[model samples]
Target: MDMTPLLLAEIQFLASFSFLALFMALALALSWMLLFFKLRVRLTGDAGWTAAYRFWVRIFALCFALALAACLPVLAQLGSLWGGLMDKIGNVAGPLLGYAVLSVFVLKSCFLGVMLFGQRRVSDTVHTLSVFMVALGLLLATAWMAAVHSWMQTPDGVAMVDGRYQVYDWFQVIFNPSFGWSLSLTVLGAALAASFLIMGVTALQALRRPPGDGERCAFKTALIVAVLASLLQALAASGMGDVISRYQPVKAATLAGYWHSGDEPELILLGWPDAATQTNRVLLAIHDTGGRWLGHDSKGYLGLDKFTGPRPPVALSFWLLRVSALLALMMSVASVLTLMRTLRRRMDLAALGLFWRKVLVGMSFSGSLLVVLGWCVSLVGLLPYAVNRSINLSDVFSQATSSTLLLSIAGYTALYVVLIAAFLGMLLHAVRYGVVPVRKTTGGAA
Candidate 1:
């Protein structure tokens, strides 16, 4: 069935999250793959899969690059529809986005060319430099886009001027309210994802190949790195709890379901989300959640003033927070377990194997969950602030028909599904074929 406007908005939120997760997963996999290749080469004096890794990495990076390009139009339309501070980033984002896309493409071309044609010794060095360049580009692009997105949750320092907005400070625009913590959390999350993939591959390799001392040590190291990265990511998210609560109480409350703003909020565990009925089947609630876990406080609850009627039901935020947190924690445990198993080198691989199996399953589920979370947070986060803005007379896309909208929606759905399928297919192929191409290096390496 075709989705309604509300449903479509939800889907857009879900789609953005889905895209972000895919982008992050691909990026994480690519980063650790490079690191693994580097370590192996340094230790054993073999470039191994560096060439194939670059090929896949470039393809993956290009996908996100294009996805960001596509978001430009979507953000523009959203800005026109919402107006006010909503458009601030979109206005500035166009040129910045253009520069980013061109930069990524250029980096990809440089890496692809070097990997394909450069001599053995030079190729490794050139490939390493190219990958570093791409990493830098990704860091910048993710930060910029995240700033634009997180701004929607806690808009600040924007003044209305005769039905238009006059942004007073450029730094403030970029900084927004939750700028620092949000950016940090995203970067940490990306790093965690990268480490997880690396260790995951390491673990898989160890399982398939007979246990040798060298292989066991390598697996242990990868798992430790992944575990460390995952822990830091959790801490980063926790550090931002105050920001989510104060600047985004609805999100906080939705995440944890704390009612009637006060000194301490309890954290909820598992629950069925009946947002329509405004009731969460609370499985567990922690005690004494206090002021400004990230920054904002009781005043953060006040930010809900931007909403029109009764505010969004608290249940929505309640369920989302619990689910996202649970998945993150489960993944963390799996990483730690993998690390422990690899270290013992006892060859009793059943436990670690189960953990890897869970991860693969969890990874599949996380795709949709993250998509839903992204959409919910982005869309609902905007409503409170936009309600205070001047109204536009016509709908943003008046020229577009229902048919056009459907076609647009359907096309995106198909493309992303195919993109996801292709990515998973490649991942499984890597498992089957290993990182080093079985065939001798060919001209088509690019």
Candidate 2:
């Protein structure tokens, strides 16, 4: 095989999946935030909270729309690019995908309309319940999708027979060893991303005009949420490290840049991995940390040499994991600093200096960036296998010509670029101008 077409197909699928995942995280985070805002409105009866809800709802709608739009390419690619994968794992994967899709549809058709458009017609309590339902729907959808991907990572409860995977236990399949950790990390990542997005937009709004009560409330709330989410995300990442190391040691070794099995492996802080030589050139690292991190002792750790199967692209996995870790650290620092400033200034956005404001704005999308990078690491690290050790990419990759693959990639790239631009344009416009006041129509004959 030339490998060109397969490479192109991988690129196309990755691009599409990354786009979808980013928007999905945004939408999921925003949905929960909306519920919180709605509850604040009901309890405090503050007009500012209402203003905050109105402002953010627009962004949520935009994110949800883009998420849906992004889904089509991913679904299309399942058949168009990796048709053979379905032949092997469809019994396990098909129902999970359907559940994810159905959850979204149920939310949109039932609760989303009430949450979005029924705010005026329904009572405050009713509207709040609708928001809660919508949030639950989003959570369920995320869980199902995470279950599908996590199963691919661990692949339990399935017996291979006649070239197909059949589920022997639904419980094990749904809650595969990695599923809980994956879901926790994903949801926390979304919350963190959404918090930063709110902080950044609020800061932008403050910079544009005099800071309002609604803006202060939103900024403070998001700051608090960011702090909590970042802390929880760190813990979740640590837990996920255990899962990955246990189930996917090769990926763990690649991510840690470990070449030889030992109790204490050097943690590569900065290096370039050369697979051809199986060494790290231009190395900068610290030793004696891997044992503690991997929860191993006395030469219990397995390294890259322990695996004779196909290895992932070493440099890509190594750097992506490091970059994501660096981003998480930066976000933690930023969150703490913002919290201190918020406490000192008492939610006064105007008191925050321009430098800090710019930092917030720059990091507004950091959560989304972290999510994408994390997904890239997960997918890339699982390379050559569509389903762990069972189905290799060579077996499932499309037979499409390189030209056709290239054309589809180009088309998807263009489409995503436009969608992203539109999202940014609309979001900036909304933040700058703020929401327009709608006239409450009263005394209508029902």
Top candidate on lDDT is 2
Error of 1 at 402 (Å): 5.6
For model 1, the superposed segments whose C-alpha errors exceed 4 Å read 1-3, 32-36, 39-90, 109-112, 115-123, 156-158, 198-222, 262-265, 272-281, 290-313, 346-407, 435-446
Write model 1 residue lDDT over 29-75, tens digit each, in one string. Answer: 44544545554555565333434344344445554554555555455
TM-score each candidate: 0.74, 0.96
* lDDT per residue as tens, model 2, 1-446: 35598888888899999999999999999999988888888778787787888888889988988998889989999998898999999999999999999999999999889887876687667778888988899899999999999999999999999999999999999999999999999999999889999999999987788878888878878888899999998898988898988888888888887887767767778889887787887457777776544434356888788789798888899999989999999999999988887687876677788899999999999988999998999999899799987899979887999888888888888988999999999989888788886444543211
